[model samples]
Target: TDLAAWAHQDVPFDRLVEALNPERSASRHPLFQVMLTVGQSLGSGPELGHLTTEFVVPELRIAKFDLTFGFEEHRTEDGGAAGFDICVEYATDLYDA
Candidate 1:
């Protein structure tokens, strides 16, 4: 599917778990938040994804997503690249439904 289609799809929970690493659970990485803003924007039902607020050390070296929020870059005080560095596994809620 295309990027647009992919963005509107629901990602499975198992897939998200598999993407994270087993170690580094105690690291002090910044938290990443992925909200179902689009769905709510279109006056849909409750938030699609049931998010579990916790640290996730990803082991997968996947390419950056083409989403506006997920793929944008950030500059930190330490002169290091900073951005959404964790996996966002959630089901999509289409506004056109």
Candidate 2:
């Protein structure tokens, strides 16, 4: 997975956050700041509805989330923007005991 590879290959976390914006959203959350300083979301999404904005991986766990840009699975007639759906999904060795 790209994310795993990035960690293995030493890609900066900041770049990862920059590329982590939502594919389809009315507005974007300030995710880059959160993921950098703290490793989780503060859940400051709009007051009305929940937003699926951040992706979290703990420091002890390594993840390879198969996400890519420019691979939109659908398009709207109104010319709104969307992005890659995970052709492959996230995988980690951790399991519930």
Candidate 3:
């Protein structure tokens, strides 16, 4: 299945609204679905750290996630040329923003 589609259905908006807010009886928010998709992709295990590869998946209750892939320059103590550094930012943002 497509990555985006997987994320979209990973969690239902109605479920999230009911779980997070039992008091509200309104319809689900569009952001809820979007957030769940991004959250599931970024929070997936064995994709980042090497040590935690053996562990099972954990429960992440998030509205959404943001992932960024990039590289940076690094230098050795002796001022020698170093290889590029990889960096990632995993975050869950509230829909209010």
Candidate 4:
């Protein structure tokens, strides 16, 4: 029921944050300090009607949150499970190696 409720409600994240009005901080996210995302990887570029497309990963070092974990599943040629690519993004100022 919670998932259905969430699906019916289309609220922007910033608007939700503003409505909630969690404690503001210059060093962390307003509502959450960490986040996680899991999805399938984009293996190849898609073809448009008459244009070519590609997926380009930008070289970004900025962290919007204190920590974020991303998991992407890659498939093989025959649609078999190839492997998983895991990445952890953290704020350098908040964490040290």
- The top-ranked prediction according to TM-score is 4
Candidates, ranked, lDDT? 4, 3, 1, 2
| Higher-lDDT candidate of 2 and 4 | 4
Specify the poorest-scoring 10-residue window by lDDT in model 3. Answer: 33-42
Where in model 1 is the C-alpha error above 4 Å? 1-10, 20-31, 34-36, 40-97
Q: Give RMSD to native, each candidate.
A: 18.4, 19.6, 15.4, 2.3
Cα lDDT tens digits, model 1, 1-97, are: 6997589468675565566543444322222323322211112244548853543347454322222233334456665755533334432331121
lDDT of 4 by residue, 1-97 (tens): 9998689589887888878889887867788889999999897689887888888878588887899998999998899999999989999988995
TM-score ranking, high to low? 4, 3, 1, 2
Candidate 3 per-residue lDDT, tens place, 19-64, comes to 6665432344434322211221122346565565544545454322
Clashing pairs in 1: 10-91
lDDT-better candidate, 3 vs 4: 4
Candidate 2 lDDT tens digits, 52-80: 55534355333233221122243445545
Best by lDDT: 4
In model 4, where do residues sit more than 4 Å from their true spots?
Answer: 48-52
Q: Candidate 2 at residue 32, lDDT?
A: 20
Candidate 4: deviation at residue 31, Å?
A: 0.7
Question: Would you estimate the TM-scores of all the predictions?
Answer: 0.20, 0.18, 0.21, 0.82
